[model samples]
Target chain A: MAPMSFAGKTIELDADGNLANRGDWSDDLARELAAQDGIAELTPQHWAVINFMRTVFEKDGDAPSIRRLTKESGVDTKMLYALFPKGPAKRAAKIAGLPKPKGCI
Target chain B: MTQTAEPIQKVSIIVSRGSLEGVYPGLIMANGARMEGIEASLFFTFFGLDAIIKKRMNSLKVATVGNPGMHMPTILGAIPGMSAFATSMMKKEIEKLDIPPIGEFITMIHDAGCEIYACKATVDMFHLKKDDFCEEVDGVISVGQFYEKAAGAQIIFT
Candidate 1:
């Protein structure tokens, strides 16, 4: 695990680089995380997914799998990949300050 | 720095059986690979082509007879409509887990950028044309081409 500093506040990250403390997450931190994944800007579609993931995790204590995300996140599978390339579920969860999804699908 | 094992970058899965149990493992593996940021491709051949065929893809049945996993006596398994019954039960369980149906799963994995291919020999033997398959199929390729695509990647046969 490593600590990253943003706006003079130190934030801890898990070994997978996901935010270690969910309470430490902020919109600015999300933008910085997305930028590290090569997304220069977070669009509305990205927030749609991030917001959905956080809402689900808040209620369920686990992030939704990609299949669930596609079905209920108001975003389709193809566009999810386009918006968060190379593993949308894993990437989006990381940016949303949630743990890695556990399901295989 | 500690030395780390090399991650799998790509996988080429070969689906050679048409049974509901046979085809699903390969599909799940291929889809799982793509979800982990690994490249994946599925090559359907022999009876496995039924998984991608337009007319049969959605109607695949579980094999009750001769399948030891069914946990039933062979004679009981041979009873009429047993396979359909088993397949329906299995589909229900899968749906409860929120897994998509086969046809929709194929489209989802393809939409996620996993390549899907049909075996040329199997397609020709079955007299299947390009249009005979679901639109997600990338193309029909020979074993040689499949190997070429499998180069530098792990290959899984199901």
Candidate 2:
């Protein structure tokens, strides 16, 4: 397990840099993680996606796939890429304090 | 051996078959690459153009006659409508796994920024014009143009 220090608190992370303990997650920690991923500020639109991811994870016990995020999250695929850049699904999961989604599409 | 490890940044996939099973592996790989922040492009050639052809894209069938994966006797597989039956069965299974249909899958990947192109030679051989393809197709290109676009990127043949 790797440990990351954020906002004077040390947190355990998995090999992929996702938070190891879901219980340790907080809104502040999400902001910190987003910052580390190069997002300067968390906009309302960002929160919409982060919160949607968290809500889905709570029920499904896994992060939603990119397809679900685009179809059900009120954010289209292009907008998702624009918001998260690079990899929206993986990066959004990391910032949302959820495990990496396993589906291919 | 002393070379440093570098992550893949781009992939250009060549799809040469048009069957449902033959086309999906390439589409899945391209979609997966895009999901990982890697740039991906798909080049459709020969029968692979069926995947982008407007009239055929949604109707791709499983090749029941010669496909051993179905474990069916070739004689039985050759029966009328056998390919359509197998294709429908596969579609049901795919739906159970939450996989979108071919048409929707193509649109989704295109929206996700995966580049799609058709081979000009194949288009000409089939007498297909650009309008004969689905809207998602970027354009038809020559092999030379494909090689140029694939420069510095990993090339995958499917």
- TM-score per model over all chains: 0.95, 0.95
- The DockQ scores of all candidates, in the order shown, are 0.79, 0.76
- After superposition, the stretches of candidate 2 with alpha carbons farther than 4 Å from their true spots are B1-4
Candidate 2 lDDT, B89-124, residue by residue in tens: 999988776678888889988988999999999888
Model 2 per-residue lDDT at B146? 99
Per-residue alpha-carbon lDDT of model 2 for A2-103, expressed as tens digits?
799877888999978999998889999999999999988988888889999999999988778777888888988888877887688889999999988877
Clashes of each: 0, 0
DockQ of 2: 0.76
Q: Model 1 clash pairs?
A: none
Worst 10 residues of 1 chain A by lDDT: A81-90
Cα-lDDT of candidate 2: 0.89
Docking quality tier of model 1: medium
The local distance difference test score of each candidate is 0.92, 0.89
Report the lDDT tens digits of candidate 1 across residue range A1-105.
Answer: 779998999988888888889999999999999999999999999999999999999998988878899989899988998998868888999999998887888
Interface RMS deviation of candidate 2 = 1.0
lDDT tens readout by residue for model 1, B58-129:
999999999999999999999999999999999999888777889999999999999999999988888889
